[model samples]
Target chain A: MTSAASSPIEFYFDFSSPYGYLAARIIDAEAAELGRKVTWRPFLLGAVMKQTKAEPLLTIPIKGDYARHDLARAARYYDIPFVVPPQFPFASIAACRAFYWLNGTDPAKARDFALFLYERAFLAGKDISKPDSVLEAASDAGLDAAAMALALQDPAIKELLKAEVDKAIKKGVFGSPFFLVDGEPFWGHDRIAEVREWLRKGGW
Target chain B: MTSAASSPIEFYFDFSSPYGYLAARIIDAEAAELGRKVTWRPFLLGAVMKQTKAEPLLTIPIKGDYARHDLARAARYYDIPFVVPPQFPFASIAACRAFYWLNGTDPAKARDFALFLYERAFLAGKDISKPDSVLEAASDAGLDAAAMALALQDPAIKELLKAEVDKAIKKGVFGSPFFLVDGEPFWGHDRIAEVREWLRKGGW
Candidate 1:
C-alpha cells in the first residue's frame, strides 16, 4: 500500500452526476485536513453506464422515487441549494471537454471550472450540457471564453476526456464520486465517512 | 405527518439482502431507545427487482466488486460478523414464508425467527434458503420443526408471503432495509441516521 503522504486520493466522477457534485463540494476540504491531496478526474459516466448496461437511478422503479428524495435530502443535509435541472441526465460531453481543455493548461483552473459547472447544473439548475452554458461557466472561472470555445474543438482535448473514461472503465470505476485511496475503491458519496476513516487508519 | 409516538417504524426487507441483514442487527435497539416500536416485514425482493429491472448488487459490473467489499466493510463498521454464503442470492421464499407463518401467531417470536435465519445465512454462512436450513433456524427460534414443515406447505402462508411482497411493491419499496416512518420512506441501511433525525425533529 502506498503511504498517504505520497499518494493522492484519486476521485473519479462524471460531470452530470449529482452525487459527484456533492462529493466535489466536500472531498478537497476533507482530504486537506488529513494532509492528503486529491486528484479530480472528470470522465463521462454515460459511456461507463452504457458499457455496464446500468440503468439510471431515476429510471429504476421504487428507487427512482427514493433517489429523487435522497438527492434533495442530501443537498439539504450538506446545506447546498439544489434544484433538479430541467434537462437532467443531460449530455455532459461539452462540460467534460471544457474541463480537460482548461486542465491541459492549468489544473487549478480546471478544478474551478468543474466546480463552477456543477454549481450551475445542480445549484442554479442551469443546463450546463450546452456548449454555451459550459463556455459561460468557463468564463466565470476566469478562463477566456473564446479560447475555451476553440479548445473545446481541439482533437487532443476530446481524446483526453475519452482516454479518462476508458481508464475509469479499465479500473472498474462504474459510479460517480468513486474514490481510490491507495488502490482501494470506494463508490458513492455515502462512503465519504468510510473514506475518511480509511485514510485515518491507513486501511482496516 | 403521523406522530412518531403513535406510528411504528415499518422495516421492510428481503432475507437475501446483506444490507438488510445489517439493518436487522441494530434497528430494533435504535428504535427502542427512542421509545418507538418496529414492525419487521419480510418480502420477496426478487419480485420487486423484477419489476424494477434491478440487478443484484453482486451482478452489476464495477458496482459488484465495490458492493462485495462494502458488505464486509459495513459489517465490520457495525461490529457484526458477516460471511457471504457460498450459495448467495439464494431463494428466500421458504424463509420468508416461515417468517409470515410465525408472524401471524407471534410477532415477537417472528422477529426472533427472522434474526435467527439471518444469522444462519449471513453470520454462520449457512444456506437458510433451503427448507432444511429454514427448519433448523425455525427450530432454534423455539418453533416446532414438524409444525414449521407443515406451515411451509400451507397455501395460506404462501399467499401471505406473496401478499407482503405485493404490498411492498405497491408502497414503492424496491430495495432492502427500506424504512417507513409515518408516511415518509427511507431506503438503505445508511439512512438509519436520517431516520433517527427524522424521529428527533418529527419532520424536516
Candidate 2:
C-alpha cells in the first residue's frame, strides 16, 4: 500500500441523487477550508445497487417516506435550495459521461459542469435523464455541448465510467455522497461533520 | 391532529442495534436542552425487517464492511465506548420486555434501566440476548430481579411487546434509533442534529 498521505480525498456520487447534489454544494469549500483537495468521481450507484439487490431510496417502505421529508429538512439545515426534479432518480449516464469528458482536460470546469447539471435537475426541476436534455443544459451553461453530446455516446467513455464504478465498488463505496479521505470511507451527506473531524484530527 | 407542542418526542430502538445504543446515549440530554420530553420504545427491528425483506447491516456486501468501520468511527464521534458483543444482532426480546415492564411503573427508572442494559451489552461486551442475562443486568442495576424474572415470562408482557412491534410497524418505524417528533419521523442517529432543529424550529 502506498503512503496514505499522498491519496487525495475522493468523493463518489451520482447525479440523480438529491443528497449527492446537496453534498456537492458544500464539500469543495469545506475541503478548501480544511487545507485539503478533493477529487469528484461520478459513479453509477444504480449499477452497484443492482448487484447488491438494494432498492432505491424512494422505493423503500418507510425509509422512503422519511427520506422524502428528510431531504427537505436536510436541505434547509445546509441552507441550500433544492427541489426534486419532475423525473427524479433519472438515468445519470449522460451526465456522468459529460463529466468524465470535460474532466479529461479541465477538471475544475468539469466540477462546475457537474454542479450546473445538479442544479438544473434539482434546483430548476429539469429532467436530465436524456441526452438531449443534458446537452441543452450544458449548452446554456456555456459548455461545449456538441463535444459533450458526442462524448455521451462514446464507447470509451462508457468503459471509463464502468471501470470507475468497478474501482469504487472495490473500494467498498455502496452509497452516494461517499467520501474517502485517504482509504478511510465516510458515507452520506450527514457525515460531513464527521468528515471535518477526520480531516482536523487526522483519523480517530 | 393533536397540538404539536404537547406531543413528546418518541425514540424507537432495539437493544441489539449498535447505532440504536449510540443514539440512546445522548437523545435524553438533547431533548432536555430543548425543553422537551422523549419516550423510549424498544421494538423488534428483526420483525420489521422480516416483512420488508431487508438484510441486516453486517450482512450487506460492501455496505457491511463500511458499516463495521463506521460503527467504531461513529462511536468515537459520539464519545461513547461501544463494543459489539460476542453474538452481534442477537434477539432483543428480553431487553424489550424488561423495558416495557419498568416503563409501566417508573418511566425515569425505565430509561435508567435501558441505559444500563445498553452499557452492559455494548460497553462490557456481554450478551443480553437471553432472558437470564437481561434479568441479571436489571438485578445488578438495582432493579427488582425476582419480579423481573417473572415479568419476563408473563404472557401479558409477551403480548405487550408484540403489540408494541405491531404498533411501531403501523407508525412506519422500521429502523433502530428511529425518532418521531409529534408525528414527524426521523430515522438514524445521524439525524439527531436535524431532530434538535425540528424541536427548536417546530417543523421547518
Candidate 3:
C-alpha cells in the first residue's frame, strides 16, 4: 500500500449522482486540510450499475423514498443550493465525455468544469444531459465551447472515458462518491469523516 | 406526522446485520439524551430484500468488501466490539421469533434479549441462527429457557414475527438498522447523526 502522505486520494464519481455532486463540493477542501491532493475522476455510473445489476436508487422500493429525502437533506446539511433537475437520472454520457476530454489536457480546468456542470444540473436545475447544455457549462468554466463540442464526439475521447470506467470497475468502485486513500476504499459522502480519520491515523 | 417528543423512535433491524448490531449498541443511549423512547423492532432482512429485489450487502460485488470494512470501522468508531461470524448473512428468523415472543410479554426484557443475542452473534462470534443458540442466548439474558423453547415453536409466536416483517415492508423499511423518527425514515447506521439532528431540530 502507498503511504497516505505520498499518495493522491482518488475520488471516483458520476455526473448524474447527487451524492457525487455533494462529495465534489467538499472533497478538495477536506483533502487540502490533510495536505493531500485529490484526483477528480468522472466515470459513468450507469455502466457500473449495468455490470453490478444494481437498480437506480430512485427506482428501488423503500430505499428510493429515503434516498430522495436524504439527497435534499444532505444538500441542506452542506448549505449548498440544490433542486432536482426535471430530467434527472438523465444520460450523463455527454457531460462525462466532456470531462475526460478536458481532463486529458488541463486537469484543474476540468475539475472546474465538473463543478460548473454539477451546479447547472443540481443547483441551477438545468438539463446537463444535453450536449448543448454541457457545452454551455464548459464554456462557462472557461473551456473553449467549440473545442469541447468536437472533443465530445471524438471517438478517442469516448474511448478514454470507457477505459476509465473499466479501470474503476476493476478497482471495485461500484458506486459514486467512492474514494480510495492509499488503496483503502471509502464509499458514500457520509463517510468523509471516516476518510479524514483514516488519513489522519493512516490505518487503525 | 407524530410529534418527536411523544412518538417512540422506531428502530427496525434484522439480527444478522452487522450494521444493525452497531446501531443497536448506541441507539438507545442516543434516544435517551432526547428524552425519547426507542422501539426495538427486529424484522427479517430477507423479507425486505425479497420485496425490493435488493441483494444482501455482503453479496454485492464492490459493496460487499466495503461493508465488511465499514462494519469493523464503525464498531471502532463507537468503541464497541465486533467480530464477523463465519456464517454471515445468517438466518435471523429464529432470533426474530424469539424477540417477538419476549417483546410480547416484556418489551424491556425483549430489548435486553435482543442485545444479548447480538452480543453472542457479533461480539462473541457465535452462530445464533440456530433455534438452540437463540434459546441459549435467551436463557443467558435471564429468560426462562423452558418458556422460550416452547415459545420458539409456537405458531402464534411465529405468526407475530411474520406480521411484524409484513408491517415493516408496508412501512417502507428495506434495510437493517433503519430508523423512523416521527414517521420520517432514516436508513443505515451512518444516518444516526441525521437522526439525532432531526430529533434535536424536529426536522429541517
Candidate 4:
C-alpha cells in the first residue's frame, strides 16, 4: 500500500537525454496512478559525465549505433513521437539553469517548462540549448519570456543548476532519467516500470 | 498465433558478464514457453571492450556505485540467487573455448556446460577463468573431462570463439545478453520480457 507521507519521486533528468525525454513523458502518470507526485529535477549530464569519464552514448563506436536504434525503438514502444535534435548531444546547461530558476519558486511551471524544452529538442527539433529557445518555451508554456531570458543569464540561476547537479551526483545520480523514491535509487528509462512497482509495493 | 518456422533466439553473452550470467540462467525457459529454442553464444567481452574503448562498469566513479547497487537489485527483481565473483572481470577465454569445442558437435552438452560454468562462477564463486575450472565444470555437467581439458588448449577451439566474436561484432552485438529474434536486436538482460512479448506478438 501507499501512504500520504511517502516522499515525492525525485526525477533527475537532463534535457539533452533522449531516454530522459521518453521517461519524462510518462513518469508523472505512473506516479499519479500510485497517488504519488514527482518532482522534476533538470540537471546537466555533462558535468556528471566528466566525473564518470564516460563518453556520450552515441559517440562510443558499436554501442552508439545500438543506442541510436534502441532510442527510436523505445520511443515507439512508449508511443512517444521522437526525433534526434541536429545537435544530438548538445549542451542542456541553458535549459537546466532555466528549470532550476523557476523551480526555486514556481515548481509546477518549472516542470511544465522542462517538458517543453524536452519536446523542443526531441519532438519538434527546436534548439532548447539556446537561451532564446528556453525563453520561447517559457513563453509558450504561458510564462514570462523576457523575465526568463534575464533569468537564463543570471549568475544566481547558473549557480542553482550547478548546485542541483552536484547534489544529484552526491545522491548517486549519474544518469538522466534517474529516480529516487523511498530513498531508493533507480536509473534508466526502462526502470520506470520498476519504479511503479516500487511505488505500489513501497519496497520489495 | 504461433509459427513453427521461428528462428532460435540468438543469445550473445560474455562469460565474465554479470547481466549475461543472470540472463543465461533464464533465457532457455523464456524461449521454451514460446515453442522456440535458444542458441547460447558466448564471446569475450575484453575484445569488444577494446573496440568500444569503454571502461569496466564497476571502475567508473559515480556510475560504478550505481551499477553495483543496480546489479544486486536486479538479481532480487528476477528472484535469482546471485553473488558477485571475488575475481570479477576475470578472464573467461578458457571457459569460452571449451564451450565452443563441445558446441561444434554436441550442442545440448555445450549448453549444459555453459549453465554449470555460469553457476560455478556466479553462484559458487569458482574461478572459471582457469582451464582447470573449465575441465571440472565440464565433468560436473557429465561431459567428457579429458576432451574438454584438451579442448581448452586446442588452437581450433580458440579460433571458433574468435570467429563467433567477430561474427557477433559484425551483427551489432556489443553487449552481453544481447538477443536477435525475428531478425530484431534487443540488448541487456532486462529485454527478456520484451523478447517474450516480441515472440508472442511478432513485434509492436
Best DockQ goes to which candidate?
4
Question: Clashes in candidate 1: how many?
Answer: 0
Winning candidate number (TM-score) = 4
Clashing pairs in 4: none
Which parts of model 1 have CA positions greater than 4 angstroms off? Answer: A1-3, B1-3
DockQ scores for all predicted structures: 0.58, 0.60, 0.58, 0.70
Q: Candidate 4 lDDT, tens digit per residue, A64-136?
A: 9999988888888889999998887887888888888888898997888888888988999988877777877
**Candidate 3 residue-wise lDDT at B110:** 90
lDDT of 2 by residue, A10-31 (tens): 9999999999999999998888
| Residue-by-residue lDDT tens digits, candidate 3, A1-204 | 867477889999999998998999999999999888999998988888876678888778878887888888888888877887888788989998998888887899888888888889888988899899898877777779998889988999989988999999889898989999888888899889888888777777
In model 3, where do residues sit more than 4 Å from their true spots? A1-3, A140-142, B1-3
Docking class of 2: medium
Fnat values, one per model, are: 0.53, 0.60, 0.50, 0.62
CA lDDT, candidate 1, residue A133: 86
The better candidate by DockQ, 2 or 4, is 4
What is residue A60's positional error in candidate 2, in angstroms?
0.9
How much DockQ does model 4 earn? Answer: 0.70
**What tens digits encode model 1's per-residue C-alpha lDDT throughout A52-124?**
6777777677788888888888888888787778887888899889888878788888888888888888888
Give lDDT: candidate 4, residue B199.
69
